[model samples]
Target: MSFLHSLGLFATLGLIYGCSTTSSLTSAQQRDAYLQQFIGQTSQSIQARLDLNSIGYQQVLAPVANDQTLTYTVIRPVTIPVPIAQNPADIDAGNIPIPVTPRAQSYDVNLQCKIIFRLENNMAKSVYYTGRTC
Candidate 1:
């Protein structure tokens, strides 16, 4: 009986761990799909479509007159639950009560999208898009 219980517990833990890891991969895949549409497009076109001003820009590498690389980072806010105070006396003694509800917290996840454009004679000759979310 003890062996069976231990096996079940391990199985449950394994499933939980697997799920947590898979979610990040899924997020990365989704971001990759969205960035694919920018391939073969000029930097100006991509900026216009994505509204670079609203998201804010990160780095601009323009080593020469014709070649330019633009990096844009987008941040999404996420809310998560926090532990509530267990001691009733502490809550009463403090001015603020222990929040039972979830509080807004900022996660460290950020998506960085880079657009590299090579121009020849003031015309875009090649364009590349790469992004990662973590």
Candidate 2:
């Protein structure tokens, strides 16, 4: 009985640990506050503040002719696999061996961070970001 009780305690502790380790995305408010620091800063300065390898920038034509905006976008992809269940009834009826095979389906979860920097006189006049982060 002591062994069984110890097993149950371990199982409960395992569940608690597993639940605490689950990953989640950063809150929108937090992301907005972090991106707000880029306003009035040059692209070079912004690059200095973040990991350059993870950052991508593009030049886009603004709504007004001859105006341009620099946009920076970061993307992280998480791969998750579809779960499969075995048909116990079919296996028992056919006395078949369990098949060894790879999973048939999986999906890529894309977490994106996009920041638009409006430029005036080669300096960032305004900054805004949109998208999710995990």
lDDT of 1: 0.47
Query: Which residues of candidate 1, in runs, are more than 4 Å off?
Result: 1-23, 51-66, 85-101, 104-133
For each predicted model, how many residue pairs clash, with residues at least 3 apart or on different chains? 0, 0
- Backbone clashes counted, model 1: 0
lDDT of 2 by residue, 8-45 (tens): 66556654554344233343445555656777876667
Best by lDDT: 2
TM-score against truth, every candidate: 0.42, 0.48
lDDT on C-alpha atoms for all candidate structures: 0.47, 0.53
- Candidate 1 similarity to native, TM-score: 0.42
By summed lDDT, which 10 consecutive residues of candidate 1 come out lowest? 76-85
